[model samples]
Target: MAEKASESSNSISLNTVDGKIFKVSPTIANQMQTIQSLIKAYDSSRVISLPHVNAFHLSKIIEYLEGKSATTVSAVKEFEAQFMKDLSLKQLKGLLIAVGYLKVNELLELMPKTVAKLIENKSVEFLRKFFGIVNDFTPSEEAKIREEIAWAFDGVDED
Candidate 1:
């Protein structure tokens, strides 16, 4: 009976897609809504498998959760800034997808805003290149679309 109680109270184990295991306190696990639901549905002692989350992304999410618990809001804000800045574009996209899947609310809010800021004031060509989107329209078709939506291009920054 005591062992059962202890097992229920133990830290949650998470297995990432890349096969790395992470142990997180209940407090941290509850912050991720997906993991929280999984914990509720299964025995807490069982390892929760995250098929969509890789080790790097999981580590970053855990780091964000642990780092943001600072005593001061300013310190947390600073930490969040540095965290976002440290990720490359590829890393940012992967982390954002993982955060979305895990339903990490704070990161879901922060990452999209960070992405918006990155592409803000940039031209369409720059955005296409930034996102690796291939332009499929021929020259005449492109010209027609541009003419129709000229207002959107009015204040676009040069590529």
Candidate 2:
């Protein structure tokens, strides 16, 4: 039946905030909670507009979803590691926001854990530099805060 044929079709179009369109399979689109909900609420043929996610992040998320179904666990792990390695901090942050918005649980966990590992044992100055955060505290205020948490600085890994 034509209805059955149409029901079996898995293609879904996702329109990004910047107007970039990605045609993805149901398996890939289902990886995103937001997209999955949209598909469930509307026709699969409809172009689901994601107002918050950009094309670059959406593409990367799709890439991740596509790679996640690898036959071997090691292959998936390798792909995920390489994917994280390929992204800069800024890109990672953007991807994290997109992943969070899309409710990609695996990526949400993996990305934050990766970022935490990168920042682990790093000094406050190093964190400030890596995150591009300005230290708004005055010297006295900083010294007090540092003194309160002096133990955090001890045993830090060398940069």
Candidate 3:
């Protein structure tokens, strides 16, 4: 009986990369499918490790998870808008990918808006550099990508 009780009780701790342990509920853990499967599949009761997610990002994700669960929808949206404003493009991309994987709706909604602002009114060179996209295409292909999004690229300075 004690073994069974201990087993059930041990499943909720999430180990982040910076050595922080997040004692989350199984139901909340289930909200992250990646975490849910790892928990369900693992035999041990020790903390589940999240290597890809660093401490800062993990803490933010936790805040997002807890915030959404506790707050009103409008409040969550407002917070997300403010939150994305402070994050760098690299952090934004990471957050976008993480939030996308976690299936958190508010963060997911903010990603496109953030990306649009970063790329809007910028040159192709800026877009390429911002996204770390190498110019694999030939000059013809470059012309094509630009011609394809003429409206999106219109009125932009040469880059």
Candidate 4:
């Protein structure tokens, strides 16, 4: 019991699926809604196990939380730009799901903005390919959606 209690005190230990433990500061842990809520209401004698988050994803989440926590608000905009720059589209997509699960507001905000920027001038094929989202709609339906946002298709290299 003491061991368990100690585990939850200084750090909310996350048991990742890869059989790894991620020990993060309570403050950093709180940046993740799942962890924050767990620590807030837990008995402090149980590990806040995250069976779904594998070690790799957990590591990235923790890194983001720690970096965001340490940065000043004034510098966060710059840091946000650089942070998104470092991730590939695949990593960004994975991070999007992870950060959304954790409900990290800053990450949530930054990620969508980055995705929006990427798609703002992208071709239909480019957007679909980038997100791996199939154009499931029938041709008519697809054309409707596109026409609704017709301004988006204004400029492209397919000319």
Candidate 1: where is the Cα deviation over 4 Å? 1-9, 123-144, 154-159
* lDDT pick, better of 1 and 4: 1
Check candidate 4 and list the clashing pairs.
none
Candidates sorted by lDDT, best first: 1, 2, 4, 3
lDDT by residue (tens digit), candidate 1, 1-159: 111122445888888888878888898899999999999999998999999899899989988888888537878878989999999988988898899999999899899899999888898888787767899999999999999998886677776
Cα-based lDDT for every prediction: 0.86, 0.82, 0.70, 0.73
Q: What is the lDDT of residue 140 in candidate 2?
A: 100
Local accuracy of candidate 2 as per-residue lDDT tens digits, 53-149: 9989988887787677754787887888999999998898888889999998779878988999988888888888776789999999999999999
lDDT tens digits, residue span 56-156, model 4: 67777766666766789998777777878988878887777777777877677778988988767677787777767988999999888988988766676
Worst 10-residue lDDT window for candidate 4 reads 1-10
Angstrom error of the Cα, residue 140, model 4: value is: 3.3
All candidates: CA RMSD (Å): 5.2, 5.3, 5.7, 4.7
Q: Supply candidate 3's per-residue lDDT for 152.
A: 73
Cα TM-score of candidate 2? 0.77
lDDT of 2 at 2: 10
Clashing residue pairs in all predictions, respectively, total: 0, 0, 0, 0
lDDT, residue 96, model 3: 68
